[model samples]
Target: MHLHKINKVLICILLTYTVQYLMLPFPDLSAEEGVIFENPYKKTEKQTDVTQFTIYFTKKSHLIPKQDQVRLQSVADFLYRNRNFEILISAHSVEGKTNKENVLISEKRSLEVERFLLIHSVEPNQIRRLFYGNSKSPNLTKEHEALNRRVEILLQPIG
Candidate 1:
């Protein structure tokens, strides 16, 4: 096949896979009345976001967008219900700052997220935090700098 035809075939395959993955029901852990689940992937009538997600922040800003408030509430609810699950929240900031200032910005972002979770009744012990300032961020162009300024959330079931 010609190089162009091969490229088109590769792109088609990737797009098809992406669509299928998105359409399928996510492995949501639905809780009812304080019951502990054996399998998190079990499907249910009412699904909540029990998976990992990101909270993005604007450049040099620690505030979360108003639109993401609802989503964070859902996460808070999930963590409150599943006491055996633990969440790691790592706050990050964009490059081009002194280490002291970078850490300060990330710290503010962490506090904001932790406060939200606490207000929603999530147990303080169920949460873990890390501050990764511009130190961990890779060198990137102007357009990609926004990607580095974010708070990444990860979830795992505790023993």
Candidate 2:
């Protein structure tokens, strides 16, 4: 009787462990998150004579600098002159922060650029914003890596 009781207890413990292991969720070992920031601009396959430009964030703050506006205005002017082109706004961030925080920061930066463009009379429909928060770093240098926190403007031909 004592032997039978010990065997039953061991079997129950083994079954419990097996069930727990089977119910555990697996981690996402794939690289789907790694590709979120690649080619954020979604540039179309149309040709245009307008020159492209870029605006860098360089930090996690919500402020947009005046010089950045100057650059954006220049792009806006080019868009005004050549109304047949579309602007792709790709926003990026640094790699130290949490993914959620990085995504939010990138989004804010993109929105700031979008607002600046709209204020300058650029059509809302003509501009598209892409947030890549820290997934891709343009500047690999440690000091300048923060500069990778920026938005790139890609100009493509519109239909």
Candidate 3:
């Protein structure tokens, strides 16, 4: 009789939770600032005229690859010329690793990019870093994993 009563209580509690969860409203995803930043890789007509580009990294590797050096240097050179602009280095990694490990890897990647820009004479103040672990995957496909492992550089006017 006691066990039956306990099971009934558990069922009631779970049902209450389910009902509450089902009734909850969806979250608001709109930006509070009203300014939406477009992915630099996919520039549409409206997103054009924004100085932005992306440099890709390999799996589990933070150092900028040899082929990508020229591209990264170009970004650094652009910063040298554009004194009013700040570069946002949004780094991402996808290894299906733990959150902590993913974040660490992404941070390392962003830092490596920052170091390279600094070496190329880009102003340190003009560089902003954002590290996102595997949390933001572009897609689940094996091919998309490579796409997700990248650093996107977007140039914005300093406020």
Q: In model 2, what are the clashing residue pairs, if there are any?
A: 93-134
Superposed by TM-score, candidate 2 places the C-alpha of residue 65 at a distance from the truth, in angstroms, of: 2.2
Q: Write the per-residue lDDT of candidate 3 for residues 1-159, one digit (tens) a residue.
A: 999999999999999999997776764543343122332443323222236756667688898876457667777787899888888998888774688988988999899989998999989899899999877767656656767778887888887
Best by lDDT: 3
Tens digits of lDDT, candidate 2, 50-91:
356555454576457665566667788877777787789888
Off by over 4 Å in 3: 1-50
TM-score of each: 0.65, 0.60, 0.64
Q: Is 1 or 2 the stronger prediction by TM-score?
A: 1
Q: Would you list the rank order by TM-score, best first?
A: 1, 3, 2
Question: Clashes in model 1: which pairs?
Answer: none
For candidate 1, write residues 62-93 as lDDT tens digits. 88777467778878888888999877889888
Poorly placed runs, candidate 1 (over 4 Å): 1-50
lDDT (Cα, 0-100) at 119 in candidate 2: 83
Q: Per-residue lDDT for 25 in model 3? A: 79
* Model 3 worst lDDT run, 10 consecutive residues: 41-50
Give the count of colliding residue pairs in each prediction: 0, 1, 0
